[model samples]
Target: MQLLGPAQENLTPRGMKARGALAVMGTSVNMQIGRPRLQDLLFSERDQEQGAASIRQLLREIRIALGPHRDAVVTGPGWVGLDGQIVALDMAGRAGADGRRPEFAADLDIADPEFEDWLRDARSHYEDQADDQLAAGIADDGTPALILQAPMSGDLQAAVTAAMILQEAASRVGDVLPLHVVHGDPGIGKISLGIELGALANRSGNDIVILFAARLRSDGRLLWSRRFVLPAEDSAAHLRRVAGGVTVAILHGVEALREVVTDPRLRRMPLQDVFSYSAVRLRRADEQLAQIDPNGDRAVILALRSYIRHTMLLERLAKNPQEEEEMASDMAARARELSPGNPTALGVNAMVAAWKGQSETAFDMARHAIAIDDENPIARLAYSSALTGMGHHREAEAEASAAHMSALSELGPAAWVLRRAIAATRIGDLRSAERYFATTHGYAPENRPALRFLSAIRYELGDEQGAQAALQKLKKLEPDFTLELMASDAYPVDSLRRAGLLKITRSGLI
Candidate 1:
């Protein structure tokens, strides 16, 4: 199972094929594979008789490699399997001490197309397995823990309602934020924070007030306390409305705690550091994260690095696009490897993939991320970008709208609105495109691309003065951007052409 060392170069064609066959079987179901399948994978270039003969010869070579443990390769009537009881695969060794999974069969240079196909799939399979193992090995490493205190009253209905409210609020806050909410008693060692909920009746007794209080568990320092009044006969809709207000308060409290808390685990400074627009800050954040967790097994940290690289590419901060793309790709791949069930990591991976122009990969990753967390604005934005790239303009617009609506921050909505505007233009909805572009510009007035598209859309819509104003703003931000540059094959020329701006410019409309 471990076939990636320097000695692999000494492997003869037969020895290489033998190791390849073992790799195929090892990654298959129950460590077993059908003989016909193995032959097809390893010797598809040969005729049936030649392929069967090659499989037999390869098996014999494997037996010789095994020596005294030759019987570990158990051959049935039409299938080959490894005896799990006798031959234990050291998956950890295959993963390496540093936890990076080496390329499967890296030394095998078989010319058969079928074998190459199988090798690619086998590599992906083992890579996921290695990622899971490595992720499991990573400790919590001082992650802050939140414990929900039980209600003092014996009224189960009130407790359930209060818990539902807290849960709904937390969902609104989303997992993209670095906050861990755990439901447990104080006995759970060193709980960083504690939340308690209680219900009180209004003086008129026609309404109930739900009190939410959070405090530091370490020294019982009060952090946040608020009360939400609900109707005595509150409906599900009403409760959700209350939860929305509560979500804002909770976020504000969390931000305040992050600002004052000195504990690295409580503050989550690395994650906070990544939100800045400066490349220097992002690089420093990445270095600090690596120092905090040297193993590089934290999927979120890797995903953040990928996000940083992609952001650098977008902001024109990266001096070399090719190098930034490679770094983003590597960080995304590693993050996806270590993140089995995490939607944020998957969303970041999807965003990076879309930025790299791997439309199909971006579509799949974004879909999986959305399936895991439909409300994730990043995932939705990524999906919209992929759809737009594939010319599914209407679908892209819908997803982009959803992303914009659900986005918590101005940046998220700005990106989503820009995509929506682009998709609208592709679909020939000029008015909607203009509106979306204006919204994007409003969110980030310094956004040069939004300004460019907004100007183009207004001009196409015959709003010459409006277009001129937008163009003036764009010129202020990017002096090189002009009607001549827009007509040329420079950045976003295709987009301008799609908006009919290039044609208008050629018509002497300025």
Candidate 2:
């Protein structure tokens, strides 16, 4: 891995798609060569034969160039070949008598773009393999890494604001806020900020555990208890065994966030009250700022924030419609008046319309949004969700796939994958569902909705053991899951989506 670090670092985001190949050492009939399991060679028909011939010719040249030492050359994986395989050597030690193994390994500047591309791909492929093993429940030593890290870099203001909020929440006296709701526009970095806060708490000597909310199907009580005592059979019992510690759980997921806010047990816990990157707050602040300077440079930003906040309100109402009457009163006209030309606003408006069961308006708004700015991933994701609500599974999948490929952030990709997985599942495309499910799992292993979807997919795919395993993991995460609770909190209320979910639940070991 150390030998290939430079090549991995050289990979640009666009360069990641280019196929890689090797072209050297193609003269000696006596020498042999080996290659890693690369994607391009595995998939491409022409590259298969060309790659094999190139490697063979390169080995022949190497054997002829080295003279008598040609016998010492051992083919290996990675860049360097050793013992007839690509091997990563401990270069700190002295070189062996056989010159094939270098005494001290020097970093090679792989000038060939193809070779560099191969190295980068191989490095990422192996890294993913390592992560999968870790996720498969590897036993840990007594000393565990306490710091919670975010996958992507976080905003400075978001991080600092989260830290401050957590610190402030710690000083609350009596009848304090149960859960500090970090409300925001979709794809606005609320979860990312939560992760950054968790890391900060970890650094401050707190036991920080971050969980994605989408990974469970139970009530907030069971969900919180489950993560605290994971790997233990009795989740609630383990919570009692560990008496005292400044443990802060930074949960990320809209469903999980909703549950936490409503849970009665929150008052007893030490939760940080963070509202980092909230569109609602931004809108309120903008309203105040307008008083000072009516034509302020931030008017456009304020307008967009208002639209986002309204859209978010509609999303919340979609799940639990208790606030529908209160929110829908003047929100529609306000949303339109705020950002009429913005594609994102139109997409969000579509979602709001769909949630309200206004199919015609939703479909129209979604198409208009896409026509205006097809590259806007957030808008695309919103439109895809709207399509799903209207029972257009195939169309939803296409929109989601496009958004997934174009998404620049960790959360956006995860959201798109989840949308695509659900759409594929509805259309009976189990393979696509399974693939997207895996990608979503990679992004957020503990996401409850994702775990449920994966379990259902595995069951339908005839992998009963895999399905049971997923259920077992879900059980450990949400011990209170039941048919009633699942219907209420797990599946959407849309008739088609609900029926599809019912089939899966009945088929699976749920």
Query: Which candidate wins on TM-score?
Result: 1
lDDT of 2 by residue, 1-510 (tens): 121112212111111112121211111122233353332332233366775555555455544544544553455554323332331222121112221222111233444555556456645654454323323211121111111222111434333333333333222110111222332111111121111122221112223321221112111122322122222223233231221111222222321343444433222121111111233443454343344334433223332333444433422312334454334323434545555765655665666676667887888887887787565444576688778777888898887876666422233356668888888887888888878887877775545566677776677678888777777776765667654554564344343245354444565365
Model 1, TM vs. native: 0.59
Question: Which residue pairs clash within candidate 1?
Answer: none
Per-residue lDDT tens digits of candidate 1, residues 288-384?
6565457877676677777878777765567788898898888878878887666767877877877766778888888898887665555666778
Best by lDDT: 1
What TM-score would every model get versus the actual structure?
0.59, 0.37
Question: Which parts of model 1 are misplaced by more than 4 Å?
Answer: 1-144, 151-154, 164-174, 185-210, 216-252, 262-294, 407-411, 475-495, 503-510
Worst 10 residues of 1 by lDDT: 4-13
